[model samples]
Structures are given as C-alpha cells and as structure tokens.
Target: MIVNLSKVISELESGSRPKGGVKDGVGSIASLGAEHLESNGGFNFKKVKYVPDEFFRSQSKGIIRSNDILIVKDGATTAKVSFVDDNFPFKEASINEHLFRIKVNTELAIPKFVFWYLFSNYGKDQVLSDFRGATVGGISRAFVDKTQIPLYSLNEQKRMVKLLDRADAFRQKRKQAIDLLDEYLKSVFLEMFGNISFNPHGFNIGKIADLVSEVKYGTSAPAIEKGKYPYLRMNNITYSGEMDISNLKYIDLAEKDEGKYLAREGDLLFNRTNSKELVGKTAVYNFTIPMAIAGYLIRVRTNEKALPEYISGYLNSLHGKQTLMAMCKSIIGMANINAKELQSIKILMPPVNLQEEYSKKIKKVHNLKQKMLNQSEELDNQFQALMQKLFS
Candidate 1:
C-alpha cells in the first residue's frame, strides 16, 4: 500500500525551470514565454485565460508543454490538477507561481493516473501539508519533486481510464438531462404564466410583499464542529438549487437560537449574499433538519394562501430573477439582497388554482431534475473511486 513514487518513476525536479503564476491577461504561449499556464479549466481549454509575463519575470516563469500535469500550488483550489491534453491552445503553458506542473515520465507513469492522484483527497492533503505561507499559501517546486506518488502499469492505467471515461460520460449525460429539465420548466412557466407583460385571463399583478406573511433574516450564531445543531451556511446551497450535505458545518445553539434557526419542512431558504449570478438563488426544504441558518441566507415562510412550490418556481423564473437582480446592490466582491428589497419586488397573481397548477408542473419537472442530478453525482463518485483504484 505504501509506494515510493520516486523509485517507480522519474521526477521532473524543479530549478532553472520556467516559473509563472496566474495573471489577469491573455496571450499566446510563444510570445508569453516557454511556460504556459491557466488558472482554471475543466481539464480542457475550450475557454481559458493565460498568465502574463509582466506579473512574473521571464526567468521565474515555469516551463510547460503539452501533456504536462499541472498542480495548483496554493489557494483553496490546491487540490485541483489537470493534464494538458492536445486540445490546449498553447504549445507550452505556464502556471500560477502558486501552481506547479508535473512532467511525468510517460513511459514509467501514466499521465491520467498521475492526474487522478493529484486530484484525490489524499493528494490534496499532501499538497496542503507542504503549503508554506501565512496569508497566501504556496507550494514550492522542491516540495513537488520530493513528494512521493504511486505508479501503475500502462495496461492497468488504461483499463482504469476506460472505466473513468465511462463514468464521466454518464455524468455528462446527467448534466444534460438536468439542463433539459430546466429548459422544460422555463417553457412550462411561460405557457402557464404568460410572458411577464401579461398573465392568463383574470390574473392580476401582485406585490410580493403582500403575498408573503413574514420574511426574516438568518442567524449569525457561533459555529462549532460536531455540535448538536447543524449550521446551514449559504455555501451549503448550490447554484443549481441542490443541498450539498457533504460540506455541512455545525453549531451549538441555546433553545432561543434553536427556535429561530431550526429549519422545518416547507421552509424556503434563499441565498441573500453571493455573486451576482447566484445572489437570488432559492431552494425549498422538503426534509427536516435541526439547523440554524447563517447570516448569508434568509428564511421565508409563506402564508397558507401562497404555496411553497409556486413561490419556488416563480422565484426561479425570468421575471422574478430580473426583479431580484434589479434590487441587488453589488459591492467589490459580493452582491447582497435584503428582505425589504425582496418583498417590494412584483409578481403576477394568478388564481389559487392556477398557482397550484404551476406547482404541480414544477414538481414533475423537479422529479426528473433530481433523477438526473443523482445520476450525475453517482458518476462523479464512481470516477473518483476508479482514480483511487488505478493510482493507489
């Protein structure tokens, strides 16, 4: 189980190698430098940004080439590493000085296997452990060359890659399904609610504040690990409106705080603070949890007349989203939506029955969405497991 990576493969030791880091500019590799690097890409560069030499001197920039395995040196994204495939635009790429590219001996070690190891949890931990800095962390080149990595035979690596490829394919399909469902829901909403300009016969324009009973902000309670109560931070919710329980945090709260923050079934959680694209994102709880909402979110409880499904769908609609965006005030780093602003936004009023009808359509769409997302998650898990089996 304990394998010495150096013994099994050759190490592309760093020193006198080109060094570079992320920059806020775009240019070609030859003109930029011998080293080419990208800050973030999905293992391919259908769209990617290149680092500028002005930020890093010509001598300090690290050398990169096609088929190189990039290692993010520092930052919260340290664990993310990708192999430079043929599709990359640059003949050579440079990395953020915080990142280092691993040029593995292809004959001794499989590039895909090396990429998988760098992406694994264990590898992430290893990279984090080597990080040296106070405010901004960074991994040194010497650290990477000395770090141990496992190696597998070419045939075994190929087999593992095949399995992983299949899993990735499945994940892609799931993502497509989710996207399709989203489009379907949008079409259904327009069909039922009409364009924002008008509504179905007899429907009237309604102020959102009047329709909802109470709009309250979440708690700013102290958080603790493994506490009695869970802390639902805004990050716990995804842009796609799914609950990510894996990274859940907890807090210890007294009875008063518990009563205030405890999320019950039918409650709607809205992300009030985030990027402009995600500021107005919303999710409804169809489940129960003893948790306190963080300051970054708001909890809205609808009156008996208003339905959770109807509100959730409406909030996700184009008109609703536009209204929320209009209310948003953006600061340097984040955009914020307040309760007052949210309430003042306008929504079209349909009859209670019509609202219920829209709710049912959303439910059906949500079912298909959930299935697709579950499949995507399953595929992602399987791919991760395959990486471990192949490299470790």
Candidate 2:
C-alpha cells in the first residue's frame, strides 16, 4: 500500500524566524542551519549557527527533538535530508527558516528508513517537481504533504534500516582512516621542520618573492557549462592544500588564453578572495590533465630555493595560516591578499637540499594517502549505488 507524505508522518515544521539576523553572537539557544546537514549521516556541530534564546522560548513549535527528520526547505541545497539520531545530544536547538523539521509517526514507520528514502532518486524527483522559487528554490509544507511514498511493514523497514546503517558505518570508517593519514602527514612535517610558525630551529627568514620565480593571477574568462579544460576555483581546494576535483567546473578558454592561464604540475594555487576564514586556502596542482585557474586564484611557481611541495606544506601549516590571516585585507565583504602582498609575506627557508628531502618524504606519505582516499571514494560510490538500487 502507498500513502501521501503527511499521512505517513507526524509533524512538518519550519523553524524559528530570525528576529534581526542570523549572525553569530552569544545566544541562549543553539540554532541549526542548512550547513549543518551532512551528505552523510551526521551533523558537523562546528558549522552550527545560533538563534536568539528569547525567540526560541517564545516559539510553540520548531524545537528540534531527537529522531525528527530534517530537510533544507529552501536555497540551492533544497531537497537535502537528515534524520536526528537518538544519540544526538543537543535537544534545545531549533532550525532556521531555511529548514523543515519533520517528526515521523514512529508507530507506523521507522524514521531511519524514511530518512534514507528521501535521499533516493524517487524522493528527489518528487522534490524537484514540486520546487517553487524564482531565484532560490524552496519547498512548501503543502508540496511535501502531497507527494506519495512507498509503504512497508514495520519489521521490513527495521531490517532495511539495519542494512543501510551497517553500510553507512563502513563508509564512515574508511573516511576516518583517511583523516588519520592526513593527520600523520602533519605530524611528520612538524617533526622534521618543527612548526614553521616560530622557526623553532632558528632558520633564516626570507620574503616569499625571493623564493618564487613567478606569481600570476588567473583569467576572468567566462565559463560555459561544458568545456575542454577543467577550471580550478577556490572551492576546489581544501584548507590543507589538497585538491578536491569532485565539483570541478570546465571552461572553453581560447587557445591564446591557455598558455597564460593554464596551470601545470607543482603549481601552488592560492584562494585570493573568499570569506576571511577561507582566505589564503591553498592547493598544489598535481593532476597531469590540463586545467585552468579561475580569476580568484593566484598561481605561484616556486623556484629552486623553495620546492613546490615544501612550500605548499609550509603555507598550509598552522604557522603559515596565522601569517596569511594577518596579511588579509577585506574588500567589500571578501577577504583578499594580492600577489605583491603575498610575495612579501615572510617564510622560513631551510637549505634547498633539506627542503627537497622533506618533499620526497611528503610525496611518499601522500602516495599512501591517495590510496586510502581512493578506497574511501570507492566505498562511498558502492554504498550510494546500493541506496539508488533499493528505491530505483
């Protein structure tokens, strides 16, 4: 048998309206945002924002409870979903206007089972069909209530939930393992170079311009949906200087533009303009495929004095991060450090041979890291495939 969405569940709620704005400050209640929802099964509390305590106290509803389902009701991330696990500790938290807090009727259906179903293609297709917004898409409670869902007996739902939970746990384990390897790389760096922040070993400090041969900004070329060269943007690089090509965009850069804008191996890409917290995030381009950097990124080609690998590692280190943050200048709302300013930043330059040796060691560790990352990606892909199959 099948039922409409509202028929199968208990509650549908949009969270507290912001009194003034959602800006962070000392607040009585912790508030949830769309950012807190993970593509995976958990919340990243570090990303959780806040709501005024008085506002939360006045609300008759919208208080988040454990076991309630959550969805991003508006914005480009519309249709994303999560189920509040019993293990979730924060019971006082409420959602922002951009989310819908759902409480499934537990007696009729398992919330966990329904949560996974929403992430499936069937659920997404329904959501896409009901999408209502001109600028940023949003879903109304009325739209969600009208959609139909497949029904299963309680025992079957429990069984399916168990299987999916196991798969999810396995995928999470793989991710955690990769994170450990990344930490190990940082540990090794500190052991060899001893935190570049204070130059604990008393190495000679040199200007960034003295170590790098050339520094250039990427083109402002307009990008098409599909193109020849992969376009590297700020979001493609992680804070730790690793390249995440998952959401890479492409551009049809002209032939003449390629020679100027195309980035090669060993090039360090710096995020020159972004939120202050994300400003100066760096990534080393190691992919052999031809790729072009976007206008917001500055490409730094290191010379013999500073090995590309060593400098990338150094710049992403804690000391490097502190130094970069200090050098940042806010323009409009975006944080930026121009090429000339970037070139003037101080760096601890070890002997060329020593830096090269450290680079070799870093390469070996990265080789291991890539292997684990590959496995993690494969596991996620397989699990995703299974999820699609169940609701195909």
Candidate 3:
C-alpha cells in the first residue's frame, strides 16, 4: 500500500536547525552527521565526531535510538538515508541540524525494511522532488511528512529484508576482493619502483615538463543534472589515485567545450583546486567513455617517455601528493598548483620499458577488477529492480 511517511512513522523530527551549539572535545558524546551514513548501513566510525554527553543526556539535541531511520535534509548531500539499527555501536548518538529522525511505529512498519526502501531509487526520487531551494536545497519537515512510502505485510517485509541483506553480503565480498587486488598492485609498485621518497634505484630525475606534452586546465562549463556528456569533478578523484565513479555527474557540453575539455583514455586528471588536505588528488582516465572535466581540474598528457599509469600512480603516491601540496599556492579559499608550477615539479624518470612491463603485469589484475566492477554494477541494478518491484 502507498501511504504518507506520517502514516508509517509515529514521529518525524528535525535535528537542531543551526547546529554547533554543543561544544566539541568532549569524549562522552558521539555526534552523528550525514557523513556517518555508510552505503551498507549504520555509521562509519572511521570518520566520527564527539560532542558533550551532557547534551545527549539532557535530550537537548535529537538523540537517535536503535531502529531510527536518519535522513539528510540539507545541502548537496540532501536526501541521503541511513538506518540506525541496534547493532550500531555507541551507547548514545545525536543527529546534527542537517539530518532528520524518522521513528517507525513498529506496529505499522519494520525499520530495516523501511530503510531499504528509502535507500532505493524510488525513495531518492521522491525526496528530490520534495526538496526546495535555489542554491543549497533543503527538505522541510512538512515535505518529508507528505512523502509516501510503499508498505507490505510484516511477514513480507521481513522476507524482503532477509533477501536484500544476503545480496548486500555478496556485494561486500566482491568489494573485499577488489580491495585485496588493489593492495597487491601497491605491493607490486613498491617492489618494482621502490619508494618514490627514497629513490633507491638512482633513476634520472627531471622536471615533469620533460615527461609531458601538455598540462592544460579543464573547462569551466556550467553543469546540468541531465546531459549528453559524463563529467568529472574534483570529488570524482580519490586521494589514493582511484576514480570513484559511483557518484559521477553529467553535463551537456557546449559547442566550444565539446573538444576543449574533452578527456581521452590514458589521460591523467589532477585536482588543482580544493582544501589543502584534498588538493592535488590525481586519477587516470581509464574509462573508455568520452567525458569532460571541470575547471578545477588539470589534464596532463604524457609523452611516449612516460605512461599515464606511471604518472598517475606517481602523483597519487604519498611522495607525489606531498610534492604537489608543498608547491601549491593557497589564495582566497582554494589551493592551486597550476600548469606552470606542475611542469616545474621534479619527477623521477625510470626507463619507459620498465613502466610498460609493470603496466602489463597490473593489466591482468585490472581485468579481474573490471569483472568484479561489472558484476557489482549488475548486482546493484538487480537489487534496485527488485526493490522497485516490491515497493511499487
């Protein structure tokens, strides 16, 4: 049955509207933000926050108990969903101003079942439709209340959750395999190239300009939600030198930008503007699809002397990032290591043949990694399909 969230949820409350009233540095309370919501479920303690326990104890902020569904209500990450299940660690946690708490009435709905629904495509579409604002959008309490949820019998809901949980487990294992292969590649790079910091191989060193044909900035095109061309943003490149394509955005390229900021396969992307901590992130354009990059990024086209993988890996390496960060200029609020400075940075140049050999070896592992990625993509599509069918 299709029913408003107000029907299924006993209460819907927004967290503190303007957060940060609570003092930090207090270990007793763990403050929860939209970032805590992980893909699988629950909180990610890897990047958690601590607030004063007094606030949580006094019930000043919205304290989330087990089985509460958390939804983000503001900014770019608006509409993100998380289920705070009993297994979530921490004796107490409170939501910040940007989140909302939805307590399901156990008599009417199952928390995990409802969580999987809200995490589905249908749920996100509904949330996005309700969002209001010109710049940074927001979800109001009334809008969320008016949001509809598809419900089923309790037994049917339980069975659906059980099946979805099993599917998620398989995806988790696939992710683990990919992580292990990545680790193996790291080891191989270390064994062949040695530490970039130590330079034990005595390779000849020269400015990066000698190894690249062009270092050009990307397009400053206005982006759209739906477009003909896939686009890369600063956030698409991870600090570890891998592309996170799961959340890629698209923009219709203008006539002038069609070929101006186009990224070809084997091109290396460098984030030229960001916070000091995340600036200088680099990733290879390994995907075959034609895509455009944002102005905040720089594209480096390497000469025959250097492979794109080699250059990308080198820049992503601990030493490579440190070198870039050291040379960047922080002005206004963004950091930049423009084309000129990037070309001047000293780089270790080993024999191109050695880099080719390493690339060939890594290709075998990448093939398997690609297979896993395909399988995971298929699984996600199937999961969403089933979810939509059940809910619709």
Candidate 4:
C-alpha cells in the first residue's frame, strides 16, 4: 500500500534551544544538532554539546527517545537522517533547531523500517526535491507530510530490516578498519615526533609563514555540473586530512586566472571558513592533475623547511585541532581563519629527513586505505541496490 508519511507518523516536530544557544559540556542534558547526525544512520558524540537542565525541563517537545528518527532540517547537510537506537548513551537528550524529531506510530509501521525507507535513495530524493532557500536550504513539515511511503506487512518489514542490518554491519566493519588505520597513523606520528603542542622533543618552532613558500587563496568562481576543470571546495578536505574528490563540481577559469586559482601537486589545502568544529581542515593535494579551488579554501606550498604531508598531519592531530579552535574567530554562525591568521600559528619544525620518512609511511597507509575504500564502495552499492529493489 502507498500512503503519505504523515499517516504513519504520530508526531513530527523540529527541536528548539534557549536563546544564545547551548554550550559544550555546560549541562547534564545532551543537546544534539545537525553535526551529531552521522551519515550511517547513527549519532556521533565525538564532540557533544549540551543544554542546561533547567531549560530542558521547561520544553515539552523535542525530548529525545529511543527508536525516534532524527533528520537535519537545514544548512549544507539538510535531509540527513539518523536513528536513535536502544543503545543510545544519553538518558535525557534534546535536539536544537537544526534537527527534526520524528515519532512513528508503532501500530501502523516500525520505526526502524520508516528510518530505513527515509534513508534510502528514493526517499532522500523526495525530501530534497522540494528543498527551499538560496544560501541555506531547508525543508518544511509540509514536505515531510506529503512524502510517499511504501507500506508493508510487519513481518515483511522485519525480514527486510534483518537483511539490511547484516549488509550494513559488513559495510561498517570495513569502515571501522579504515578508522583503525587512521588511528594507527596518529599513533605513529606521536611515537615519532611526540606532541608538537608540548614541544616534547625540543624541536625548533617556526610560524607557518616561515615554512611555506607561498600562501594564496582560491578563486571565487562559480562552479557548474560540467566544466573544463574539477573544482575543489572546502568539503573536499576531510576532517582526517584526506582529499575527497568523489563529490566534485567543475569550473572554467580564464587563462590568466588558471595559474592563480589552480592547486598543484604537493600543495596543502586548508579550509578557512566553516563551522567551529570543521574549520581548519587540512589536506595534501596528491592528484597529478591540477584543480581549481573555491574561495573558502587556501592553498599553501611548503618550502624546504617542511613537507605538505607533515603539516597536514599536524593540523589534523588532536593538538592541532585545539590550536585552531583557540585561534579561530567566529563570525555569525561560521568560523573564519584567514591566511594571515593561519600563517601566524606556530609549529614545531622537525628535521627534513624525518618529515620525508613520515610522508613515505603515510603514502603506504593511504594505498591500503584506498583499496579498502573501493571495497566499501562496492558493498555500499550492493546495499543501495537491495534497498531499491525492496522500497521501489
């Protein structure tokens, strides 16, 4: 049977916080935002924010419960969904204005079944098809209410969920392996260089400007679906210091502007403007072909004093993140770390040969990671196919 999503849903409302917003670790009640919603249909509390106990008690709506589905309501990651499972760590939690809390009517449909359906490609397309706004996109409750859902028997829904759960677990294992490798690299870096923040090795300290031959910002050119060259945006650089060109747009630059805006091999790309948690993301450009970068990113060419890999690794480390968080200035909702500010931050300068050795080790790890990523993609494709067959 086909029906509007509103039929199966008992409650649908977005959350709200007190004016001036919540603070990190300020209160006992966990306050989830869009960032807490993971792409894998789960929550990520790696950086948890909180709401005051008194304020949480005052609100009647937005109170989180097990088996509830959450979706990002606005901004760049609009329509992202996550399910609050029984294993959720927080006993009392509420979401901020950026997320919508969904309660399913158990008698009509299963919560996880609805979550899986909304998380599917077909459902995502439906949700985003009516996406409104220019600078910050969002969807209203009307859109969610009108979305079509495929209804199935409780037994059939359970059967499909069982199959999907197994496939998702397999895919998650591969992702966990990749995460472990990243942790391994962090350990290796600590073992070799110690913590740069403490200057444990007594290495010479130098500002970023001293170690870089050039620091230049990217172009403000408009990107299209297809153009002469691939366009690199702030999102291209992952929080873990890796380049993700998979979701790339393209741009065409004038002859004179090409040399100014394009990123060459071995250059370090820095995301200068983003949310407080994501600002200062750094990655080394290893691709042979040059790509034009957007205005929000800055390209740095390392001098003989430092390697791009070493700098990127340092910036992606725990200490590096702390440093960035301290120095960055928040403007409106976004944080900014311009070229001048980035160039002034000091770094521990290790020996040239040591930096080269770290680079070589990282290369090997990246090769292995790429292979695993390929396998993960294949698994994900299969999972999506299964969903299409079942939900279509």
Candidate 5:
C-alpha cells in the first residue's frame, strides 16, 4: 500500500513515537565552499570530510548518523543518495548547504529500509523532480522531508535490508574483479616491457614522432536525431581502456562524412580535452561500428613501420601518460596536448616482435575484461529487480 512521509511523521509525534524537525534545514548549495567530503566504496566508514570550516559559516549544516539518508540536492549530482554507515567518521558531521540529511525516529521507520525506498524509481523521481534552478539546479530540504516514504513493519524492514545487503555484496565483488583485471594487465605489461628507467642490457629512448605516422582529432559532427551512427566522447574511455556504452549516442552522418569520423577496428582513441586528470585517457576502438569520434577525441593510427597495438599498449602504460602530460600546455583553466605536441613526445622503443608479444597479452586481458563486464551487467540487472521487488 502507498504511504505518505508527512502522515508517518504525524503519527509518530502523536503517541509512543515522536518525530523530530520537519522544517528544511539547509540553504542554497551555492553557499558551500569547495571543500567537501569523500565517500569510500569499500571501507569501514562511508563519509570522510574534506570541506573546510570557512565553507560552513552561515548555513545550518545538518547532522548525519548511522542509517541517516543523505541526498545530494544541487548541481549535476542531484538525487544521489548515500546511507551513513554505523562506522562513518562523523556521526555529527554537518552536511553542507547543498545536501540534506534525513532521519526518522527508529521506532517509526527503519533507516535502511527507507534508504532502499529512496534508492528505488519512486524515490529517485521524487528527489530529482524537486530540484529547482535554471543554471545549477537544487533540491530543498522541505522537498525531501515532505517527500512520501513507504512504511513497512519492523520485521519487513529487516527482511528487505538483508536482501539488499546480499545484493550489494555481489555488486562489490564484481567491481573488485574488474579492479583485479586492471592490476593483472599492469603486471603483465611491466613483466613484458621492463620499466622505462630499468634497462638490463641497453635500451633505445627516442621521440614518439619516430615511432608513428600521425595523431589527429576527429571533425565535429552536427547533432543528429536518435539513430544508429555510433558517436563516442572522451568520457566513454575507461581506465582499463574499455568503452562504456551505457550513455553512448549516435550521429546521423552522410556517407561522405562517415569516412572522416568513423572509428576503425584497432584505432586508438585518446581524450584530447577534459579536466586535468581526465585528459590523456584513452581506449581502443574495438567495436566495428560506423562510428564518428566527438571533437574532444583524437584518433591515432599507425603507419606500416609502427604497429597500432604497440602504440596502444605504450600509450595506456604509465610511461605513455607521463610523456603526454609533459607536452600538455594549459590554457584558460583547461589543459591540451595537441597532435603535434603528442607526436613530439618520447617513448622507449621495443623490438617489433616484442611489441607484438605484449600486444597479444594485452588482448588476452581485454578478453577477460569483456567477460567480467558481462558478469557485472548480469549482477546489475539482478540488483535492479530486487530494488523493484523491495519497493513495490
């Protein structure tokens, strides 16, 4: 049966149970300073404060406790929510003006169950829809407290919590498996191609321009109606050089234009523009799609002399990133390393046979990545189903 949060608050206050403050506790998110808290994925505590005191001078920063629900109320991250773990560092840490910390008397509503409710489609819609702002959006405390919450008996709450706990466990294991895959790849690369500084016999260090044909960016395509032309952006590149297709968009390109932007099999895609840390990230375009790269990406194709896989593995390596960073020149808060700059960068040359051997190992790792990714997707689907069952 459907339930209203306001009614629950009222009922709790009338008899054996009593509800706390209902008034919105925070102000516009613009008030918070750059300092903020960080949440650890697999840790004893859920939140760690990075926000400074200067940021909270005027706002009535709300307290967070174990099982307290935290909803991000502003900016692009709106509606993102986290539950305060029992071991969270700050039981009384004041949430910044941009976040709303919510709690109900434990007698009336189980906090974890409430967390599951807020995590569901109904909860997400309520939180995100409450956001009000033109440029940088925000959600009000009043909106959160008044948002309806489903009520279940204490026993039912316990059951749902147990189910969710198990589901989350599976999710974390899959994530760890992905992380292990990355670590294994790095180990493989190091074993095959010794660290740049370490040359047992003798090694050749040369400028990168000597190894490859050219580095070039894809031309911009005018936005197209939803269709099949695969359009990829820099954000799609993962740390392990995999493409995330969840938010993948397509551009309708004329046949003539297709040749210019379409990504070829084995073509290496590098992020040419983004925040300092994000720029220089790369992924190999493994899928054979009539795809066009976005303006922010650069495609590096090799000549007969240099193998594409050789450069791809090198670029994804630590040494490749350091070289790219050295060539980066910042402009107006954004850093860019042009094709010329990238080409001029230096790398240690491994023999063609050795390069091909490393490439085979990398391909094996990529295959493992695809398998783990498929498993992750399956776990995600199961979790989503559980969420719907717990809420509905």
Candidate 6:
C-alpha cells in the first residue's frame, strides 16, 4: 500500500530559537540547526551550539528524542535529513528554526524504516520535487501531506532496515579507513617537519614567493558540460588537499589562453575565494591530462627550492588554514586571498630532500587510498541499487 507521510506522522513541525541566537556552552541543552544534520543520514556535533536551560524548559515543541527524523527545512542544505539515534550525545536537544522535527506513529511504521526510505533516492526525489523559492530554496508542509511512501508490514520493514544497516556499515567503515589514512599522513608530516607555525625544527622561514617559480590566477571563461578540456573549480579542491574530480565541467579555451589557463601536473591549485572556512583549500594536481582552472583558483608552480606536495601539505595544515583565515578579506559572506597575498604568506623552508621523502611516502599512501576509494564507490553503487530495488 502507498500512504502519505502526513497519515503516519503524528508530529511534523519546526522549532525556533531566541532573539539573540544560541550561545556556545550556555547550557547543557543542545540547539541543533541545519548544520548539525549530515548528508549521510547522521548527526555531527563538532560545532554544535547550545540554548539556555530555562529557554529549553519553556518550549513545548522541537524537543528531540531518539528515533525522531530531523530535516533541514531551508537554505542550501534544504531537504537534508538525519535520524536521532538512541546514542545521540545530548540527553536533551531541540531543533532550530531551519529544521523540522518529525515523529512517526510507531503503530503504523518504524521510524528507522521511514528514515531509510526518506534517505533513499525515491524519497529525496519526492521531497525535492516540491522545492520552492529562488533565493533560499525550501519545501512546504504540503510535501508531507502529499508525498506517498510504500507501506510494508512492521516485520518486513525491520528486515529491510537490518539489511540496509549492514550495507551502510560497510560503507561507513571504508570512509573511516580513508579518514584514518589522512590522519596518518598528518601525523607523519608533524613527525618530520614539526608544526610549521611554531617552527620547532627551527627551519629558515621565507615567503611562498621565494619557493615558487610562478603564481597566476585561472581563466574567467565560462565552462559547459561538454568542451575540449576538463575545468577545475574551487569545489574540485578538497579541504584535505586532495582533488575530487567526481563532478567536473568542461571548457574550451583559445590557443592563446591555453598557455595561461591550462594546469600542468605538479602545479598547486588554491581556492582563493569561498566561505571563510573554505577560502584556502589547496591541492596538488597529479593528473596528466590537460585541464583548465576557473578564475577563483590560483595556480602555483614550485621551484627547485620547494616541492608541490610539501607546499600543499603545509597549506592544508591547521596552522596554514589559520594563516589563510586570518589574512583573507571578507566581503559579505565570501572571503578572498588574492595571488599577491597568497604568494606573500610566510612558510618554513624545509630542505628539499626531506620534502622529497615526505612526497614519496604521501604517494604510497595515496595509491592505497585510491584503491580503497574504488572499493567504497562500488559498495555505494551496490547500496544504491539495493535502495532502488527495495524502495522503488
């Protein structure tokens, strides 16, 4: 049977916060906003905010409980959902204005099952189909009143949830393994060179301009879906100093512009403009193929004095991020660090040979990580196929 979400859901409403907004460490009560909801159907409290105990006591709605479904109701992350599991860190929590807390009738459906269903492509499509507003996209209560879900017996739902959970666990493990590899690299960097900010190794300090042969911005040409060469944008550079070419665009450049815009292997790409937190993401281009970079990115070619890998590692370090964050000029919500400013940032001048050794080790780790990523992708495909089979 097919049933509307409104039929099985007992509570489907959003919450609000006080006039001045939530404060950190103000109380034990967690006030979760859309940022706390992860795209992978989980919660992240790394930057969680808190509301006062007295304010929480006064609220009759938005109190979070285990098995409740929370959805981002507006903004860029609208329609994103997360399940509040039994192990949720906070004993008392509530949603903010930008989130909707949903409670399903346990007599008719399992909350986990419904969460899984909504997390699937089938459910996301239905929810996004009703998305409204141009500047700030959002979905209305009508989505819950009209969207239909496949109704299964409680026992059947339990069985499906168990299977999905097992498959998801494998995916999560793969992701964790990848994250561990990154952490291991960070540890190795610290062990070899020490913290760049503190300069514990007492290496000579110099500006990035001294170590780089060239520093130039990318082209301003618009990119299309199909063009002569792959186009790299700010989003292509991961915060961890890795390239994510999964979603790429293409651009055709004139012969004159190719020499200026095309990135060579070993070049360091820096995202010069983005939100303050992500304004300086740097990655070393390891691809052999020709690719054009967008205007928001700056390309840096290292001289014999420095290695691209070493520079990339330094820029991705905690201290490097802090430096960029401090130097960047914020206009509205976006921050920018021009090529001149980036080239002027001071860096520790480690010996070239030591950087080479670090580069070699990083390469070995990257190769291993690539294989694991391939496996993870295959597992994701399998999980999605299963979701389609079961939910569709």
Number of the top-ranking candidate, with TM-score as the measure: 6
User: How close is each model in CA RMSD to the real structure?
Assistant: 5.5, 2.2, 4.1, 2.6, 7.1, 2.2
For residues 169-218, what per-residue lDDT tens digits would candidate 2 score against the true structure? 98899888877877877777787777655678888888889889989899
**Steric collisions counted per model:** 20, 0, 0, 0, 2, 0
The CA lDDT at 223 in model 3 is 82
For model 4, residues 32-148, the per-residue Cα lDDT tens digits are 999999888888998888889999999998999999999998998888999999889999999999989999999989999999999998888888876899998899888666689
For candidate 2, the TM-score is: 0.92
lDDT of 5: 0.66
lDDT of 1: 0.67
Error of 1 at 318 (Å): 4.5
Query: TM-score of the candidate numbered 1?
Result: 0.74
- Please say which candidate is ahead in TM-score: 3 or 5: 5
lDDT of each: 0.67, 0.83, 0.80, 0.91, 0.66, 0.91
**Which 10-residue window in model 4 sums to the lowest lDDT?**
18-27
Better of 1 and 3 by lDDT: 3
Candidate 5, 340-367: lDDT as tens digits: 7767766667787887887788788878
lDDT of 3 by residue, 204-244 (tens): 88878989988888888778889888888999998667777
Clashes of 6: 0
- Rank the models by TM-score, top first: 6, 2, 4, 5, 3, 1
Count steric clashes of candidate 5. Answer: 2
- In order of appearance, the predictions have TM-scores of 0.74, 0.92, 0.80, 0.89, 0.81, 0.92
Off by over 4 Å in 2: 225-228, 252-257, 389-392
